[model samples]
Target: MEYSIEDVAAARSLQFAKYMYTSMATFWTYDYACSLHEEWTFLLRSHWSKMKGLYIATRYLPFILLITNLYMSFTPNENLVKCGMLVNITSGLGMILAICADCFFIIRTYVFWNKNKILLAAIVGTYLSFVVASVSIIVDTTASAAYATIPIPDITGCYQSSTSDQIFIPFVLFSVFGLGLMILTLIRAIHSWQRNQSHLYVVLMNHNILYYACVFLFSVMNIFTSLLLQDSYQTVLDGVQFLALAIIATRMHIHLWQTNQHLRGSSGLVHIRLSDMSSVNVTA
Candidate 1:
């Protein structure tokens, strides 16, 4: 069959778009790798804590997904069905990272609230409800794989495989939770500052607010692109955004830990006064 000029132009355009998307994903993934390298020592040598473990997973899992997805994008169409499974795995890893990152904020907020059991229980219940709904959506969408036609032969880019249109639900939930946490933190920070103007509280509030804003913006963009431009190259764009969110969350965790270490070291100083002669000693 002979194709028309318009058809040829459209195919070329689609091919261009695919290449552009892959380029952007590659660049961002490289940047993410650089960040992970910079923080490798802290991540490897820090006291083994649950938060540290979560940070490591949040950094590595999305990275692995990014690499796998890129490989799938460049592979032949014969393996497209396998690409669907890769997409599902990527989605699962993204969800896990999101939950872990949010849990970091939840723990921070709980500590800010002085570990109130009632508030902790309430927050946990709300978070779990969202998780259940989000997971259900993910499971339903990933159960079946969908394939897209590649404009260029031998390229295995992903198509919106899940027949479900509610793929944006989890991202929306993430934004909602983030906004709620930011508000709670803001309120607590303001109250505490009014009571006792502490520099530490100021720093904590600033860091939390900045981190929340960054992740919230990413989530919102992901939802918008997933819902509004579903027919376009949304899959690749969404993957990039998820990778970015993971990188940001992991960096925030490391920054928080380093800040706390600095604070602790500063707090360890001691001052001694001798009443006898004329000497005052201060040591850290």
Candidate 2:
């Protein structure tokens, strides 16, 4: 059997649509399950520190983006494709989520390092530089490009006409930051372990390493797939990566809180500081 060009395009659009819905559904289900868990009250009633606020933002932002993207996927609005507003909004939201997730790591690193003010300042400075560079790229690219609609007849949706190259810069910056944080965490964990030989430090070290590694891998793959394939499917991967980052960061935060609560209950004291390394407490 032979398929025509139109058939292929339709099939591709249909596949993309299916993937978007599936991913959105998965995010909602995971979020709902989290709410049902006993930790939900803890997450809500916990002290609203800066890090906690950022974590909460990360948790909700992706769901908002997913909902908007899903609507755009099926809205059949020709103008939505060319307006560039949606693209800008989506990109901005993604950047914000990335920043929040990275902030969580930075704070963790700072705490692991015993809340060194100098180290915290240096990390924040570096993070700010990346933010400026990313925003500059986004603004320049969006301003210069003439966005148009690529209508998919089969799916009744339209995609913005933009090259995947725009994603590379931000992703590369994020990947570098992630790798640096992972290294910092590993170093601190090792140092703490050598000093005290505590199992808690090992757990802290392992969790940070694993989360950073997973997120870094996702960032790298997003860049690779966008650069190499340059297809509609790449958009699906982008959605997945964004949602994954949000979920993982939020889960890490909740896990840390739960672990800290457990330690406090069992040991009669919580020595954990979000910006200091005094003992084997916790790092979320």
- Please report the candidate that would top TM-score against the real structure: 2
For all candidates, the clash counts are 0, 1
Q: After superposition, how far is residue 276 of candidate 2 from its true place, in Å?
A: 10
What is the per-residue lDDT of model 1 for residues 1-284, given as tens digits with 9 covering 90 to 100? Answer: 67566444434534544675577667766776776665876756576656667777776776576676666555554566676787677677767767766776677677677677898899899999989999998788777546655454443455543356788898898789778888988888877675644444455567678768866887888788778664335566666666666766767666655654565577744221111101212232
Error of 2 at 57 (Å): 1.0
lDDT of candidate 2 over 1-284, digit per residue (tens): 67667556645654676577567767667775866665467666677566667866887788777766665566554575444666567667877877777667676677778778899899899889988988987777666645334444444444434563675687688788779889998777667674654444555666678778977898899788868753355656767777777777777667776766677677745456432333345333
The per-residue C-alpha lDDT of model 1 at residue 32 equals 65
Q: Model 2 clash pairs?
A: 114-277
